[model samples]
Target: MNHINEALKHAEEEKKTRSMMSSGKLRSTLEEIKTEGNKAFSSQKLDEAIESFTKGIEVYKDNQEVVKLEKCTDLTKIAISLFTNRALCYSKQRRDANVIADTTYVIENLSRKNVKAYYR
Candidate 1:
């Protein structure tokens, strides 16, 4: 009985460690996507930038459960940036509705105090 309990505890610890590792990996991946989007945006590639940002947002949304479980503010900030940057791209393209939708999402869901979102 004692040995069985010890084995169970070990398994639980292993599971937790794996979860943490995966969380870190996801964060890194998100950061990379954000960087790529920024680069594209800086180069005046609105379409490419929008594509990268959208992909990042989708990836973040897909792993929201893990993000919430980890309680990482960094992930939330990255997500907010993705939306805000994409909104900027939409604005450049004169996509008023798309800009409004993205900014509204940031204002309504991510950060109510996001000045760029409010201004856009």
Candidate 2:
């Protein structure tokens, strides 16, 4: 039973990896960086978290590294979530305007694609 469970878990993870890989993007790695950013933030390591978050955003913004999902609805959502998380980090520094700025960036990017508008 234990072996079967482990195999099942591995298979699920592999399927996710395959999906990400087949998408022809650095979204997976960027997401990993975002995760690291969150972990760093949790540990009160602001500088490390900001670096990781910036790296993730850079990867996401790279033209050649874009996900081929055409519509990219999901990716946009992920981007917004990351931006929101970054906003929270900025908020910790009592930079409310910075939070609003990051939120505005997320909103503008989504709207630029003519996707749905989400008020931050």
Candidate 3:
């Protein structure tokens, strides 16, 4: 009984530490990447905007790997937004297939409340 209790206590402490570290650093980094993508889009720099969004997507994938290893749920709003923004850029560039692929990924894997994906 004592051994079981000790193991459970250690697991709880590890879970707390993982949650803290993941939320703080990962959220800020993702936010910065998303901001950069939005800024490029607003400036009418389509290529740069796409590049920024792509970087955000890459970071999002890395985040997912970490979340999986840590056995936690990742809040994926920003990641979905990154895909949506990339789709918008593709639409502007007349890349219909790419736009479709991105929007489909968001709609299928993320939230139904992402109305932007529907319109895209």
Who wins the lDDT comparison? 1
- List the pairs of residues colliding in candidate 1: none
Q: Which of the two candidates, 1 or 3, achieves a greater TM-score against the reference?
A: 1
**Number of backbone-clashing residue pairs for each candidate, in the order shown:** 0, 0, 0
* Window of ten residues with lowest summed lDDT in model 2: 111-120
lDDT on C-alpha atoms for all candidate structures: 0.88, 0.67, 0.82
- Comparing 1 and 2 by TM-score, which wins? 1
Per-residue accuracy of model 3 over 10-70 as CA lDDT, tens digit each: 9997785565436557777878888898999999999999999999888777567555556
How well does model 2 score by local distance difference test?
0.67
Q: For candidate 2, list the clashing residue pairs, or say none.
A: none
* Model 1, runs deviating above 4 Å: 1-21
Q: Rank the candidate models, highest lDDT first.
A: 1, 3, 2
Two-way TM-score contest, 2 vs 3, winner: 3
Worst 10 residues of 1 by lDDT: 14-23
1-120 in candidate 2: lDDT tens per residue? 999999999999777555443333455676787899999999998778877887776666653224544656566666665677777777788887877777778767654442322333
Reference-based TM-score of each model: 0.80, 0.64, 0.74
Lowest-scoring 10 consecutive residues by lDDT in candidate 3?
66-75
Ranking by TM-score: 1, 3, 2
Q: Of the candidates numbered 2 and 3, which has the greater lDDT value? A: 3
